[model samples]
Target: MSTTAEAPSSSSENPKKDTEENSESRLYQLVKNLTILERRESSLLELSKKRESFPQLAPVLWYSFGTIAGLLQELVAIYPSLSPPTLTAHASNRVCNALALLQCVASHPETRTPFLNAHIPLFLYPFLNTVSKTRPFEYLRLTSLGVIGALVKMDDPEVINFLLTTEIIPLCLRIMETGSELSKTVATFILQKVLLDDFGLQYICHTAERFYAVSTVLSNMVNALIEQPSARLLKHIVRCYLRLSDNPRAREALRQHLPVALQNGTFSKVLEEDPSTRRWLSSLLYALGGEQYNVGSNI
Candidate 1:
């Protein structure tokens, strides 16, 4: 016969160890759920190629992906300790959804106005700022720029100012200076949006002489545009320079490049033909020399 041992009394024992174990288990399960969601999202992306073949399915798929993205964003926001890698991964996926939506809306002008009216400066702003700072995961930067490209079409001055004041200009400049071809292309799109604003123009003027290093970046973007002849990228760079050189000092700094840009003819023609581009050029030329250059006529 063995002596009976009393079970540990709950009131006499520490419950902290059990609580900690429970917490760890809960965290593990949450992480596992998130990982599964992410894998499912990745699998969905592989179906994009088939989307074109089944045109009717594209919008439904985009909506589904977008819903998943929204859920992921909400979950990550709730779980602050979910890890940067996880947040970045989810953000990148959401950005892809946003970009696909943007392209869809862009191709159909009727859809564009409503989409921008609904989302600009609200969903897109924080999303851009979030992805812009995600290091070691620079692909997000490209996607952020795509969002910016879509938002730039909005005729909202406040939105434009927000982008410039948030240090997006310098960030895009850095990426344009150092990133790969595709990255630079996207950065240029975002930079174009910032440069369309008055604050962006002032920033460039203030920093113009101090950062001659940026000249090389500008040159590289120009050369790339020349090589690829991407109308979108070319239009963006021209618009950026037009806003940037709006100040007298900045105009002088950019004077060296003006002749070259003008000689290219495509940029100048676009500026002349496009109402928005024309407005910026007029403002820039007026700032530089007080409306004496006949710039408006060319525009």
Candidate 2:
């Protein structure tokens, strides 16, 4: 050929890079706005007092908030290597702001569509592993679990499996084993969601001993539940114990707690009145007393 075809320009060859850079720049601007808004707390409070004063801006705020959440998720996913301890510590703080915005949207059903439709699961998924290992910012772990709980309530398998494979159950159990009552409560909530699936239930059964070894923590959690108004916490504890009893090691470890659980009327009430609880208890009892029920079977 008389003339060589011109080489494509770098920008032309890498359009995606330009698009990503633009997205990152816009995200930085949005985050800056959020920071400014947070710093002007009194102004926001004053604005809140003015009813319908900023109605026109509400949609814009919501959209920006959702976009920030989406951007954080995309950034984390595209650059997982950047989520090291130092970076994650900073990101966790930013996530707190994101969660506040999400909570505001969550409180108003009409404004919740953007979050419920997309932003929630996106923010939640990427933070799973990061939150698990972040120590000094432990609150982020509980916050992350709360987001997962919300997604689970929404019945999203994608969210559930993401949590499962992230080893969230083990991390939660470890936190519940060593952390405060609030931590245990948060962990229990996530575990309750996990127990909804058969594979999750089986996994808990298989690792029952590890969970049961933290009996002192479990006892404290049960005691704390007694003061709570909601019966849901007590019910979840019972279900967790019942599942654990399926494993021989767990059964032996929890044998000491059984009498206390029954005497305290936590398990007893459920065994008497809750049909699902009764069914699970029956299966657990059968599993624990295998020889008693399988007298005719060869060992």
Q: Per-residue lDDT of 97-165 in model 2, one digit per residue for the tens?
A: 445444444434455455555544455544444433445346565666565555566555555666666
RMSD per prediction, one decimal? 17.4, 15.6
Cα-based lDDT at residue 221, candidate 1 = 72
Candidate 1, superposed: residue stretches over 4 Å from native: 1-95, 98-139, 178-182, 209-214, 224-232, 257-299
Clashing pairs in 1: none
Q: Distance (Å) between predicted and true CA of 276, model 2?
A: 10
lDDT of 1 by residue, 45-122 (tens): 533333343333323322443543543354245233223445557655654553454454433444444444554334
